[model samples]
Target: MFESLHQTQVIPDFDEDEVMLEDIEVEELHPTSTETEKNEWKKRKTRVRSDVWQEYTKVMVKEGDLPVERPKAKCNRCSRRIAADPNKHGTSPLWKYYTSCVKKHEANKSQTVLNSDESGSMINWKFNQDRYDCVKMYLTRKMHLRIFSVFPPAMCGTHLNLVVERGLEEIGMLVRRVREAVKWIMASPARSEAFKDTAKLYKVETSKFLCMDVPTRWNSTYLMLESALPYAPVMALFEIVNSAFVRDLKQKTHNKKSIGVPEELDWHEVRRKCGYLKKFHKLTEEVSATSYPTCHTFFKEMCSIFTVIRRMEGHEDEDIKRMSTRMKS
Candidate 1:
């Protein structure tokens, strides 16, 4: 029973070197029959190999089989082929193909929805937390006092949205600067004395200068003057003053040429010919040597009054223009 169990448990080991039959026994078999069978077996083997080759070719064609070539460099974002050479690609440590791809994707996505014009540039200011906060607060407070004086708290937000959307950030800054200019002017003893006497008439005549009134030549002058005031910044003020001076010079040159008069003339004659020159000369002398801050402060205050005027007119640009035309007349 044990011997039978051992035989049953034994497993066959198929070795290539092991002989299946002795040579003599194999030679005894029928040679013709064996030859025929061997030939048929060879033919079957060839057919099997052929079939495998055909199947492999079909698979190769279906799967787009190609040689394993070296990987080429490419821009991840644009999928544009790049040079394989490291030097050609750039050697910067921080440079990354994947990062650029992601960035390009994001930019394209944003550009698709956002405006791509000059007006769209204003969005950057909105995203700037610090700048937006300061400007928003300043404008909200100031605008509320002027235009939105009767507006409820709920309406204030709506007004702010309208202003911001209308690109009034610069206007808000202008108003603030003008308010500062007024303060400076009031603080200066010389400026106050020189202009204080003409304050009432100036107000009436310069009413067109107010942002609320119709914009006119005088309004433009006031705008330039307030815009140039030292409190705003020497650079800004200089630009304003320089522009005004150049414009005035051009006008004077034209007038002289038109009248066929000489460039050089006596002061009294000049004053008589151009009555505004006398007043301008007085204001110029008072402001010419003034500190940047003092001039800016005065300009700021002047701008504030304009802001008030603009608000009073319901923020109508047409009204400002009409008022300006009247002032010029």
Candidate 2:
């Protein structure tokens, strides 16, 4: 959304996550004329931006005021109009208005900005550190952090999911093949029974079926791989119990088609990937404690992630190295 504003209008560029502006109060929406832009702008929303408009409103003023017909932001509280030209300086002026001008604004706005929930409740949060620090300083003294205030140094659990998703993309084909294999097994009662029998033959636990991952949730994929890795040795034995699925993959491999079967190398890759992810999965579980502060523990988990990424960067596989490099960048 911010990128679109920068491309079409004279505004600063921001990542998709950066422009999540929060609206302070719900105001009447006077729809403006439609545009002819190539990109569909209506679909996009900027949520985190509400704080900027909490005390101001963007309104057009006459040409006589500034020699040019320029837009001005009218203070919602005081009805004072200020220059709002979409230029290099984006919303900095408007942000400075409140807390500095209105005495009530200072009283209403929190310096520490905990914005936290009831004690012991886990909730999703998002905030950039630079922005949070700047806002904190603007509202109060430097390093005047309130005791018990929790602010994560890294992305929160939900945002961390985006990073995990991208990393998972590095092994998308392998994941898909595993998913297909699971589907082939669980989609039929007979195949599932054969799987249990095969597991029994290999002395592998037949307590659970091969998990099929939910595409939207990364952890499901982790669970899927985690369960399937135990059956890696027995996978070749699946050819004996379930030759049809194996035969199909063999034919595809022979005919220059994409391999949709979990092979030895593929299982090896899954095991390694699962090892890396299992740590993060545990971190998320720990950080998910909402009743108490998890921020302190979060930093330690971040260190672990950094260490893991560095190790992955030095791995023998080029694919793993490529993935870690992307994650680092």
The lowest-lDDT stretch of 10 consecutive residues in candidate 2 is 22-31
**Winner by TM-score:** 2
TM-score of 2: 0.51
What lDDT would candidate 1 get against the real structure?
A: 0.37
- Candidate 1 C-alpha lDDT tens digits along 300-327: 4333433543443453455333432332
Residue-wise lDDT of candidate 2 within 1-329, one digit each (tens)? 88876785567776765444322222224233454242457667444355687677777777775576777888877787888776645788877776566634554555554546768456787768999788867545543532213233336788667767888888888887787788778888888888887788789764665888899988888999888888887777887666698866645442355766888888988888888889878887888887898877876786677778779889998988887866654
Candidate 1: Cα lDDT at 207: 36
Candidate 2, residue 253: how far the Cα is off, in Å? 11
Alpha-carbon TM-score of each model against the true structure: 0.20, 0.51
